[model samples]
Target: MKKIQNFFSGFLIIFSLFFVFHSAEAGFFDWFFRFFGKNEANVKKEEIVLPKYYRLGVSSVGSGTVIINVNEGKINCGNECRKIFPEKSLVELTAKPNDNYIFKSWSGCDYTPNEKCKIEMNKNVTITANFAKKENVVNSQQQSGSHSSKIISSSVSQKSSSKSSLVSSKTNNSKLSNSLSSAASSKAPSSRSSSSSSIFSAELMEDVFLMDDDGTLIDSDNKLIDKKIVEKFYTLHPQKTYYDFLSVFPSFEPGFQGAFHSIVKNDVKGIGGPQITSSYLSDSNKLIGVNFLGFGFTSPRIKTEDDVKNNLHYLVHETGHQWLAYIGKEEGFSTATHYTNWTDTGFIRDGQQWSDVMGGSPWKDNGDGTVSEIITNKQGFSKLSLYLMGLASQTEVPDLRIVVPENPQDQSPFNVHVRGEPKTISISDIVSRYGTRIPSYQTSQKDFKMAYILLSKKSNPPTMSQIDAINYVAKYFPSEWNFVTYGKSTINSR
Candidate 1:
């Protein structure tokens, strides 16, 4: 009977042990499956839904035709134009006027009356290209006969009178002209045009004045000399001044005024040097500033005519800064043209951290102290710098892509690709591919990693497209990235 009781107790104990073990194992399996299932459900929930696309309509007025070019398709309209294009697509329209007609303006489209019009098709858009008949002023004048002749004679007389006034005024300053003419005649032929003679004379006078005065020669302001005097100086000393060459012509192309300014102020070197401050028009982005750096001067010890001629490249470098300041200010960046002290390791020792010249090129002081050589003459402008200055054309700029590996755990390298314009990809797509948190300024680790990767992969000077991509990332994303991101430490910390 006791033996029977012992067997029953052992069986009961064994049964209890088995029940506990099975329960624990089942609980663990349930929790594990639940966690994985939750993740899978989230993945399914995040699926992307493409936006609905709509058509764009284009038309023309008068004798002109409208040619619309979109990423998806192209439409040429002679009279009434209509086409279908994807929503949010960029559309470029060109106006071609028929014979005896000229392009007038664009209607029903938010664009200036340029030969080309560009817009983003967010919804159904209708644009009209207008043209006007070209008026034959010459034919009208001929028809008028005697009256037209009188008007023509009067116009010629006015022009002649203006020319005579200019010549007479210049002749009044005969002392200055004669002095310069004598110096110019020594170098070249005496039988030169009046304009040529004036320019040569100015050049000689500038050289003489620069040599005669010490570096302490200060005009009203402590910076340099007066701009009028400087202009006259450049006119006389046209030998090496690039500004003189450009100013001799009527006007500059759209974006070359900064370049002209740089040429004129290349040799201006005194205690203060050149200083620029910009102010914007009320309620507009139009930038206006008094450029005090236009006058050209130099240190007495360093004021050799040869030194001035040799440093012509400095004008190019400095002009680049002016362009940057103007465009950057207009684009809502800091008005300061030069990089701050925090940005550059080597900067002016006078507690001023401004970049010497957009920090584009390096200037080395010759031990002789006559002139400094801008070493990076071959490297015109960095891609980032060019874009900021509005010098990069649409074709020159490239699209940006952040490439990821198939396996997140894989030790393979990641990269930022700068190529043609990318197809419309939503932010959710980026998050899914690159992970929930993409590199941003807020995420320092990810931001630095991406920046270093781009810096390593970038071309020596970088392309305009590459720079554009970097800029987009910085401006839109959380990164405070820019052209100086990688080279800040290496800048001369003088």
Candidate 2:
């Protein structure tokens, strides 16, 4: 009985202790489970994240429309424009001028005035497309003017208004026109005579070759010799005999300064071509001509077609320096000409600007010692260069227009008004014009033919007539051909 009582007493004590502990900390175990549940709820809330977006704004001044494109979305802003885009999106903006208006400049964007603007959308951005009315009276006045008048028109736009006003003065015009005509005529005959005489005909080139024989410094006629003879003479006399032969040619003499010679075995560093000047000074201290020691017209060994072609190429390239000097003096584009380096992808030579070739693209050098046939065969002045040099008339280059798509994946179309009619050209035609093989990129003939068509479609505008745009894609995006052609049906089609 006593043992049973003791057991009951011990049970009462344990029960009392349990009751006290439970009452003191009520819901302790429930709270522990709820803490983990709350942590899981917080994690789920973190998983529900928000996306990021940015704003793009565009506007225009004058008679033009601003076309803005982000991905597949497009907005045509006549006066004001705005849109939202994902971060790091590339937006293409184009300014289209109305009839009788021209694109002047761009503001609030990184782009040339007339060219297309490519923007990378990182933050809220605004851009403006500026335009101006095409001057009709000024254009007419330019057409009727003499060479001096044309120079004034091209070089000094600010003074054009006053010069045009002078055209209306009939009393002054009669005297001015007569004096200008007489002066122009007198200058023309002498200049033409000098150039015609100085031109190196095939026969003259051969004659000059004989004169340089035996490094005799001077020929029997007392004329300074060519290449090695000149080099020998220059070393002996330095200044007195240097460039004496070039003085007779007025075309080469106007901007003549001096030359540099770098002889490497039988070949010259730049193939005996002139190192074109980057400065536009009427009198510059820069090296204008270059002579290779061994490669001269005197070498009797250059009889093959390839040899003749190569020599002619060197002659043209060297003479190009003289033309560049003359162009620089009139148009102030001297700094645009530059030497060809391996990295330059564009056709514009070093130191020359875009307009130097009338927007003609730079020719790429094939490692096998051949350039594009279009460049070599034509061997003519660029349309813009011709205009600057007074070689081409206004009618030669009509209202040229290029239409680029809002998306790079879209087809860019180009149109030119010929005889007041718009002519549409296919991608194949452009490729044909450029040739099937690209020497610079070492593109295979088959690949270039296929890629040219595909790239023409993938171009930002999908269609472009501007030689600048055409050459840009052909040169810079050679690798994107297959992706744009077979991977997708159209540009940005994916």
Candidate 3:
């Protein structure tokens, strides 16, 4: 009788305390409920944690306009503009001057690069876009738009949004759940979705790369850059879903010169993405988007501007892998992702080659029924390669051929003589051999973008010279591509 009375007294104390402070949570509530043979804890006042939000104020000191681009929307700031965004959200602001005005500078931004400003929202911040009248210029055709969608993720995300941003929770510190709730004065995006899975599926690994005020997914010890950092960079871009290809340039050696890096983490196909197919190995059109990662090693290989310029062919060759190399492999005619060479039985006459960017060299049409390699390494795309890249229709692709040598020189494609017969293969033969590309030029992506980064093995940032060298590659890639592709396709790397 004494023991039973003491147990009843303890239960009453716990029940009374639980009801008295009903707004707060306590494990004793569940502990006492167990005595009543109740399996459910009867959670009445479950705690909920909210995501952090911040306010961004934009102002202009001169006569100009500022276009602010967030997750998927753009805001035009005439003179003053203000908005609220969630933490870890990326904001891009571009200044477009009036007819006679010119962009001067930006203030209160992280850093102004290529005449644009970017801000990562973590706290209440203000930015000023300034402009001034042109002094005496004929027509200031100054560009005023973003160059690349490079995402700069902040490792430290626990920063405060406001002073009273803390939430009340139990002692156990239960897992925090965050939701994209409505902000007090936030303008919701009307066009873009919160997720990018509908278009670019990275084996559903997109969320793993995203961040919040709660935590970040980036893992690194000494900040050695790799595909993870590169993937994260593209995953955070505002227009990630709208893009067809996401190219990443690292400063480190990836063992190979370049590649159309895949983002799939498993063996699932059809949505594997880029340089591979979603359905089968034959149907390459199922892949909608891809990631291309490349690197240029320093020294020995590249000591002068000419060497860097010459090594460009290697990078371009790998980029062509997005839709090349396999075109003639199955037919036993084309070389390894390139045109048929001396090793293959396919041969060409002493005539000018169509496109040698992928392979083949300019041959000197010798009068004695033999062609010689005048200069090696053709700089532009072949008509067939262009057709595969979806930049040209099959009707535009003409016949192609491979020049064979008389005296086989140990299967090497160097300063040799093209003194053998020619194997002339028409575009129809290729199309008949290896089925036509499904997503025709009409539906294929024509414009592409790339993000250039200086990856380092150590935590130290890249030197100014290293950055300039990589940037030099970025600068020349577009024009050279245009010259090769006959201005049909556009590529931008900035």
Candidate 4:
């Protein structure tokens, strides 16, 4: 009986071993590894892979040329006509209307609703900027005069990393901060009419429309879309980096970013856009060789009260673009161009759903082979973004991942459903490639200057309701900027 029992036990042990071995071979242990985040594929590599790039082709109509500028003219098209831009790259196109002809309108971009052509190159596409030979082109945008604030929004929800709301009427000094500030100094900008609508008052520019062959965009209430009202505002207040226009034209699209000039083509040293310096002409201007140009048309007529209330993210996202999501591009991180899965706008064009390109999808590592996208309501600029903006130290940034999809250009990585392999971009590699951000975050400028104006169509007075809305928004904007930056930055009209 003892011999039989031993034989049976040995047989059972052998059978169990064979079953376990077969299960292991068949991926039965995969769940365990995944649960523990110990999958072999989950190991993060401190390396960079080439980013997915899409071709941007340009076609000219009439007499002008569209200057395609990206990466400080790497493919500054129009001697080239067609060039490929990396995924998430912001492409700015300006119409150089030869002498008499004015830029008629851009034909290809369904997203660009204003004269400033800021396109997020998500896929291979061509854009056509049309210039018309006009008998008399009154380009009022070039004409000198002051105008008021205007910005437009598609109203996508956003995520903030901070839980505290700092919009109190009486802001305590203890609550204010200057992050990355050295031991001696860290304070909010003195409230010098900072958030007052009366102080940041937008001068009204009545709409200028052409009926008898001026040939600019004239459809919605005959409001001329070709000449941005804010251009005139720039002529008036050339000092401010940003212009907030309370506009009448509901056709206007969104917040656009630009630089006045770049000394060199190196993106790290304020190349395409400045990260650590102020490029615009303000009282506290620095010749960092880069300046940020932000313009938007916010019409309360078009935007609901909820939209106006929640509009801070749009401002934060666009301004953040001035210094974000581009540093790790060489190391395989794609610049995220406002793609979100939750917003099915349902507004279709060309038989397809709206591109839904407005807010960005920042991501995080789940420690497994897969990564979880930082959803809206939690999506502020990442620490990596802050570092690029000269707002955070290198130590604050972590090992960020770039998702390598099965198909590199198979839609944008912003889509949550898009599965891919996670490749980590280490900070050391970024430091090695770009070198440490000069003037470091400790000494970097955290306060920015902005101008606000109210835009009214010619002969149309801005509604009192509109003025109230703008005032309310402007009042809380500093706190909003403060919150989104996680205390790394602030803005002032002064």
Please give each candidate's TM-score: 0.22, 0.20, 0.44, 0.43
lDDT of 4 by residue, 1-494 (tens): 99999999999999678668667555546755765677979567775443466667787675445666555442323322555556788877776664345677886674665555778878877788887776744323221233332221212111111121222212122211111122112223122211112212221111111111122223454333423333343343445434322222221221222212222112355312443433334434332222222212233222333434454555555555455444443444543333233222123223433221233344444444444443223335556666777887889777655555556664553344344566666777878877777657888777764433444433222333343344444455667777656677876534
Residue-by-residue lDDT tens digits, candidate 3, 1-494? 99999999999998787666753554554655655657464645664343455667888665556778765555555456566677778888998764346688999898799569988987778899888876654421122242111111211112111111112212112121011112111322122211332111111111112111111322333222344453454455534443334444433334433355443222211111234324221132222334444434232122234434555654566566566655565444455456654422212224533435555544444566565444322356766677877788889767665565566672444323445655567778877765667667787666765444334332222222233344345545666766666788776523
Top candidate on lDDT is 3
On the 0 to 100 scale, the lDDT of residue 289 in model 1 is 17
* Model 3 stretches with alpha carbons more than 4 Å out: 1-227, 234-241, 252-314, 330-332, 343-355, 364-369, 376-378, 404-415
Best by TM-score: 3
TM-score of 3: 0.44
The C-alpha stretches of model 1 lying farther than 4 A from their native spots are 1-310, 327-335, 339-357, 360-379, 387-391, 397-494
Residues 190-260 of candidate 2 have per-residue lDDT tens digits of 11100121111111110011111232533454333444343433343343321212211101111112222
Ranking the candidates on lDDT from highest down gives 3, 4, 1, 2
Report the C-alpha displacement of residue 408, candidate 3, in angstroms.
6.5
Off by over 4 Å in 2: 1-209, 212-303, 325-336, 339-379, 388-390, 394-494
Candidate 4 — worst ten consecutive residues by lDDT sum? 204-213
